[model samples]
Target: MPPLPSHEYHVGIICALHIEMAAMRAMLDEEHGTFSKKAIHDHNTYFGGQIHNHNVVIACLPAGIDGVVAAGTVAKDMSRTFEQLRFGLLVGTGAGIPNLEAGVDVRLGDVVVSRPSGVYGGVVQYYRGKSKAGGMWEPKGMLNAPPVVLLTALQSLQAEYELEDSRMPSYLAKMLERRPKMRSMGYARPEMDKDVLYLAAYHHVVGRTTCDACEVAQTLARPPRVSTDPQIHYGVIASGDRVVNDAVTRDRLRQDYGALCVEMEAAGLMNDFPCLVIRGICGYADSHKNENWRRYGAATAAAYAKELLLHASIEETSQEKPVQQILGKSSETTRSEQDWAEQFFSKKQVTFQ
Candidate 1:
């Protein structure tokens, strides 16, 4: 393989499930370069390659927080070789916010970007420890970049498609009311089928120890940064230890938090890396989940992400060029007949033949 591009940015693309990553891989062209896969820790598969003239590394980590952390660690470590690491993007399909309509033309593919401010279990624990030790620990004061960025991106995407008022289903609403405490804590049950490797991976990744209620984990971690760009938005994302299958539970959380979307990995991955969580809405957080919509949503979001990266790369390259050269030639003179025409034109009286 040729040496990786010398650009400052090393884009990291992560998909929790194998299928989502496969779909994204198919969309990529030679402009993105070919991907090379390798075995890591003799356990999971890691796909690393270039795309869009960017050094792109794709990893479908075993599902939950721990899996995300492990993959993040690997991605971050790999970025060290580059002179500058621009950003890390988590891309894939996710369960939709409940109570939303699904139709043939709806194009369920919506992208959610996590703010850079992430809340990790370890970080939350660290602060809690400091507080217990009589140190100045305050939960309200903690802040991070990924969550903010993620939130901003979610809002922007929602507005673009006008999915702002989408809500959870009736069944999910009841579940949230019953588990009022869970609702207060921002924990929504997730829906996972046996074939859904992403949800299963999340369970395996976070493990039994770190997998706590979503609220508890996020309260400890920091949120992502809020970009001034109108394209990004910052807000709360629903995370939990279990897959939210009940419609009542999904609706309840949606109505309560006004959450833009729901997913399994954001909380887990955000727990460690202060990164972005972008989800393409696939279906409502209920039994009515549609595989076709989910796949399409994931692809749409990924395409948008690629566009963002490409634009950034072009802008960066432009800035490196000399300003004078960009202006083009200005010293050329016109024929003698044009001198008389130029003099007449100054008074706004001349008309072109």
Candidate 2:
């Protein structure tokens, strides 16, 4: 087909860490096609000439807010060149939230779309009078929140696999057992270490917070906020600058913040980007950071994101009548709002090897 409309195929795919990006490339290879790695950046890897007329731009930036901002900026810039840049998708892995159940672990592999409230710490500014002291809040104005359709796809995949076994590293698991107080707070029993929990949560939160750079004072100074209509889910993501291999810290974050997941990049990215945080439970907060489990979990979540993108692209292309009717009034509207089914079912056929 006439080189699938430029705007229809061009997408920005970003991974926060190297492993994440690698996994993403692997997935793309399976679905779209192989990606040839091009130049590298301080926070991203450029992959050009991919399948389906879609130029797959991949980035495995450093873990933190600075990395997110730098990568996002690059993605945004690269998007400008495309005649049809549909939307941006950040795919990869993350630490899962505790007490969320093994079933939900399927959701971990799904793509979590962050409908950004605004740029905060490093690049964008957060709105004023919108957040409380201990917790983060959404911004006001024309909110062009990023899409979350990606997560839906992952959820579908999770259902398909019916994979229930969740695990972490052995050393990490032992760490959590040492902290009784943390365990009481709902942090899973450690088969590993105690400090990992605290460090992961701390860094995850701090990094996300700092990256958004939600300078309330600065945002308040600006004019009315421009809101875009996009689907998004809001929740807390735990962070720590260090790799959390402890149970105590993990429980502390769950008890204190009711966080949904823990990861190195969210805190960093959240600090700068006003977006919803979704995490796949790779392993319970412990030294038992199971590498295989982590990879599968991350892939599961990322797969979900890909499915969502496919649906979204279809929606955008088809221009479902209801959506058209809703936004028909204003061409100036930056985004169109549509209700996406929260729970998704997988259609992929499974075969026993």
RMSD of 2: 17.2
* lDDT minimum window of 10 residues, candidate 1: 121-130
lDDT of 2 by residue, 1-353 (tens): 11223343445565665555554554452233323332233223355334333444445564554333354454433444332444445555555444433222212222233333224211111111143355533333232333344334434444544563222222223324443443343333223221122223222223442213333332111122132111122244544334444554555444544544555444333322222333434555543334444554444444444434443444543332221122212212122110110110011111110
* Candidate 2 lDDT for residue 55: 46
Question: By TM-score, who's the top model here?
Answer: 1
Q: RMSD in Å for candidate 1, one decimal?
A: 23.2
Q: Per-candidate TM vs. native?
A: 0.49, 0.46
Could you list the CA RMSD of all candidates, in the order they appear? Answer: 23.2, 17.2
Give the alpha-carbon lDDT of every model: 0.42, 0.37
Model 1 per-residue lDDT tens digits across residues 1-353: 54345343355566776656754554443324333332333344445455566656555666553332355444433333332444456677655552323211111444445442235221111111112133222232222335333344444555644644222122234434554553443223223221121221122222332223222222112222242111222344554333554444544444444454556555434433444666666665544335545544555455556544443453443333222222222212124323432432333222221
lDDT of 1 at 343: 38
Model 1 Cα shift for residue 257 (angstroms): 2.9
